[model samples]
Target chain A: MTAYKGYLIDLDGTVYRGKEIIPEAVEFVSSLKEQNLPYLFVTNNSSETPESVAQKLQNMGIPCETKHVFTSSMATASYLTEQREKQSAYVIGEDGIQKALEQAGITYEEDQPGFVVMGIDRSITYEKLAKAALAVRNGARFIATNKDVSLPSERGLLPGNGSFVSVISLSTGVEPTVIGKPESIIVEQALERINLSKEEVLMVGDNYDTDILAGINGGIDTLMVHTGVTTAEQLKEKQEQPTHVVSSLKEWKI
Target chain B: MTAYKGYLIDLDGTVYRGKEIIPEAVEFVSSLKEQNLPYLFVTNNSSETPESVAQKLQNMGIPCETKHVFTSSMATASYLTEQREKQSAYVIGEDGIQKALEQAGITYEEDQPGFVVMGIDRSITYEKLAKAALAVRNGARFIATNKDVSLPSERGLLPGNGSFVSVISLSTGVEPTVIGKPESIIVEQALERINLSKEEVLMVGDNYDTDILAGINGGIDTLMVHTGVTTAEQLKEKQEQPTHVVSSLKEWKI
Candidate 1:
């Protein structure tokens, strides 16, 4: 077996389920930290800043720092930076994406923007969407942080970023460039941040559709854990198998 | 030529364009009024009440009353009335839909709704959409007033009711039953309202996609005028042509 040198881990399902941290995941992460292995918590959540995400993990007794968190918002900002276009955007998101763009020196413009970036926003309104639709129609480049349709909440599945993204895309008849999991863009961005080759790193997550498919699309090894969304029975239905499968993070060797 | 006993007319393009009323349309409608021919102004706009729409037309000096206007909201309410399920809905819309649902005696619900009716709303919010998505995922029957992706405004093409409807439907992986133009439901409802059979009336409009298609879908004759969304060149590209075609309403015989 090829031992992985670094790890790119998913947040919500793999490290913690909602507000509760998984005991085995904590132990595994601690073991990685003890060995001084480089690992980054790569999340599709564009609503929280890296500092907040790191703080949440620390509160759960997990070893994490702001630098160890690679979010889709950061990936999206990085993606925009490489475009070589004007660094102005009409944005729809929360603290994370807003801060990411600000950090990247991207100016916020409502009209005649170079790009229109959409992320998860709980306070979304019609006027915001109308502006986005009009901008996109006027030929502004469209982008979405992630395309997770349904957000799992205690209140059942709510509208996710992708659902909101659809409003503009459907209205303007333009598809957005998605910068999160299930696409290789975020994975490549994570690889650059971790400073590791694809062959030496392993992507670990509980969700098959986003995390595992992302690893496959990015040409990296993936370890599917059963502690979250996809069950062992459900994983069997997929054609492309993950490189490794474990009942829990404890089942994997360091 | 068959002397049509009634007429189902479309607003916006057929009768008026934005704030300006079409002169040819006014003359044609006056001829219908002078001959005492029953006519109903059918529209996909679910934002304004029939009274408001009629007032807009009456203000334009085109003989119109509340009784002569049939909106998508009214059709949606009529649809719900024919359903065997309980008459309660979690709605996402403006005055037209709200009034129609209330007039139909359908109660407003949030927690456990029997149906989820979506329409055009300029004041749309994430909270309202979240509730609609949650309700739909909880097995509520989903319905949309119209499937017009973009709404024409003085500013530009903005996100329409169908675009907003995409949010809930995309999140829940559910398709909505559309009740407006191009679906035939509104046409059937208008026929019922005007007390006319399909063979006894002609559906007149300036847009081939919505008006003409609705007539064709509802098994009625259609007259496509060249004053709106679809141009004469565009109409020639369609596989299914309208029953009658004219450059202006003045070219048609009452």
Candidate 2:
């Protein structure tokens, strides 16, 4: 396929897995550097903020700065801050979520919250869920980091933060407005951060629904790769396909 | 307020805009028609089959199609079609996508599509869109129909199906999987054709989103009172709510 403009690369399955970046990942990024083509690490994983992701990437020998990275957590925080305007938010997640909220100038409240935010909190307990649900029931705006159903692991897969979001959603019947990958907040942020337009970017990833669809939803061309989650067999057998298909982002020319 | 297991009432700006439902709405739903109430509506908005939604209603709504009454396009179709055959499908939506395809004895394909199905064609486009997007791209499953975007007039909304679908999403996505309300193939169809479920249904109509949200997304809470899109003044102040809130579903609730 002809190279379009810049790139919007996925992080989890596309570049790295947990602490270890995938083989050829650095070179793939270096190629973008050589081309001076702007690329952003777009991830639906709301557990980590951009700064943390940048630090992680830097630790792994990938020369990425916080500016070149984006997370759904940032989008959720921005959207909530813009709309709710400094509301007192009760958060159940990680340092990433806390930092995002604080940076956005939102106050953190545990009870009678004006906002109830949920991220990928492994330490989630029924009590925490009750508190969060109670806050939402009492009129706090429910915000979720991301809705990824499963987190990729070397052990195959683990219940993602979405499972917890669902738990809270069940406790309180209000479905949180998901503002992640497929929802366009992250992509919108990426475009703004990189000074790029929809037509000037292409999204490359393995997941058909999340990564590829995010690009499509954000009004960009999408290339689906068969590196993770979706096997070649599934792609071949499935009816709906992406705008383009590749074996890996390593094979990407742009 | 004591929580009861009756009536899985919708909370989207209906009873509550963000913080709380209208006081009347809260009271009305709280004081339900019955107490042994376990009323569940299959609501996922997108990507879920009603069977899954019905199963996941927690303690909200009763999932039985017999005594209880709730409807979704998926549930409506499921009740209509019992044959376990895969018909061709050309869908413009998420995966719960295949539900209607399954019901109509249709299989979903992208390449050699048979039918051109469209429901709320969220992924709409222009020119070369309707002809190819749904039927060819997703594998034309069936020529479906859906025209509820402009429900019963007086909803004071913008032009709905006049373009949103036929021009924007539908015209580009494909013809449709189904269209129109009260059609034997639509929400009303399931109610009339199937001897199960409650008939004490109200064809609620709010502008576009509210009407469709309550109707096809899950269950027929079809309250389309002209509150939202009529004047900025209406939506500006969220006081005048709906029980059933469209101006011209044209029935006096009293």
Candidate 3:
């Protein structure tokens, strides 16, 4: 296997599953660190800040720092900055997305905004959704961090950011530009952050839909690990196969 | 013009626009009352109870009582009762839907419900949506009050009950059985309430999509008024025209 210049890793299913970290994934990241290979944890989670995410990973005994994490919020902010010079957004999300917008110098406005950015907001209210719909109808560019319809939780699969985003899109009859896994926007942005070309970077993750498909969509090689959502049998049904498939991250040669 | 035995009248646009009552519609209702024709105001609004809707109409000098009003809430409750003898629902909406479910003897359960009823909830939170989505995914029958994507408000067009309903439907990959206008369920239920057959009743409203389409879908006659959302010019684009179109309700003879 050809050695890649840099790696784009996925969180949740790839590195850890909920509260538990995959042992093989942990060892793989350690190897990357020992070899001094550049890598970034690319995640679609727009709720938690990079610091919080890094802290969780570090506590799990994984080698990670705030700079090593790149969330969908950061990608969305960077995308907005590239899309327009004057960035004012009516944002519906939690801390991570808000912080990213602030750090990117995007002002939050209620009435008339240049962009209507939607993320998974646990404190979502009708008034917030109403304001967003109105703004989008008034010709604001609609942008969503991800298009994940459901999120797996202890209780059950709950409505995700994509489901909430449908309210504005369905109501206003305007589709949003999604910027998460499987869309290629977040992967492209992550590659830019790592300062590596797509050809030189390999995207590694457990999920075939979000992680592997993201790499394929972004014109990069993908390494699929079977520790999460997609099983080996399910991968066979897919028309376009991943670049490489392994039982675990430990099986892949760096 | 045939003197209909009963009338399924619309609120918002046909009877009133916001807080102000349309004078021609007021006189039209008065004529119905004087001629001893049975009438019920059928609205897609599931937030307010029949009593509240009647109070608003009475305050505007329109002849109406609690019995003369039938909201989407009532229709949804009626549909559920007819569908299942022992119905237990996890409802997400306001006072109107809650009261209707209670009146219909449908118990509200969270953990495992037989049905997941979604309506217009202004105070909608992610927790409520999560619960509804989980319940629907767990084999609960998904039901929505209406499919009106947007509602016209003073603040402009806002996300309606249908948009919120999309969250649960989208997350669970289930299409809800809509019980409001354009679905024929509400109109059929309203016909039962008025004790009139579809041929004997004339559905009257201002919106071509909801009111007129409900009548058409229910196999009944319709009277479209030009005092609300659908202008006469806009109505021309529709392939299936309303049975009757008028500049004002006053122009039609009882």
Of the true interface contacts, each candidate retains a share of 0.91, 0.00, 0.94
Q: Which lDDT tens digits does candidate 1 get at residues A1-254?
A: 78889999999889999999999999999999999999999999999999999999999999999999999999999999999777899999999999999999999999999999999999998899999998888888999999999898899888999999999998899999999998999999999999999999999999999999999999999999999999999999999999999999999998
Residue B26 lDDT, candidate 2, scale 0-100: 33
Cα error, candidate 3, residue A74 (Å): 1.2
Q: What is the C-alpha lDDT of each candidate?
A: 0.94, 0.57, 0.93
Which pairs, if any, clash in model 1?
A: none
Per-residue CA lDDT of model 3 for A211-246, tens digit only, reads: 999999999999998998899999999999999999
The fraction of reference A/B contacts recovered in model 2 reads 0.00
lDDT of 3 by residue, B49-146 (tens): 99999999999999999999999999999999988534999999999999999999999999789999999988899999988988888889999999
Which CAPRI tier for candidate 2?
incorrect
Candidate 1 lDDT over B13-72, as tens digits, reads 889999999999999999999999999999999989999999999999999989999999
Model 3 clash pairs are: none
lDDT ranking of the models: 1, 3, 2
Number of clashing pairs per prediction, in order: 0, 61, 0
| Candidate 3 positional error at B201, Å | 1.3
In order of appearance, the predictions have TM-scores of: 0.98, 0.49, 0.96
Question: What DockQ would you assign to candidate 2?
Answer: 0.02
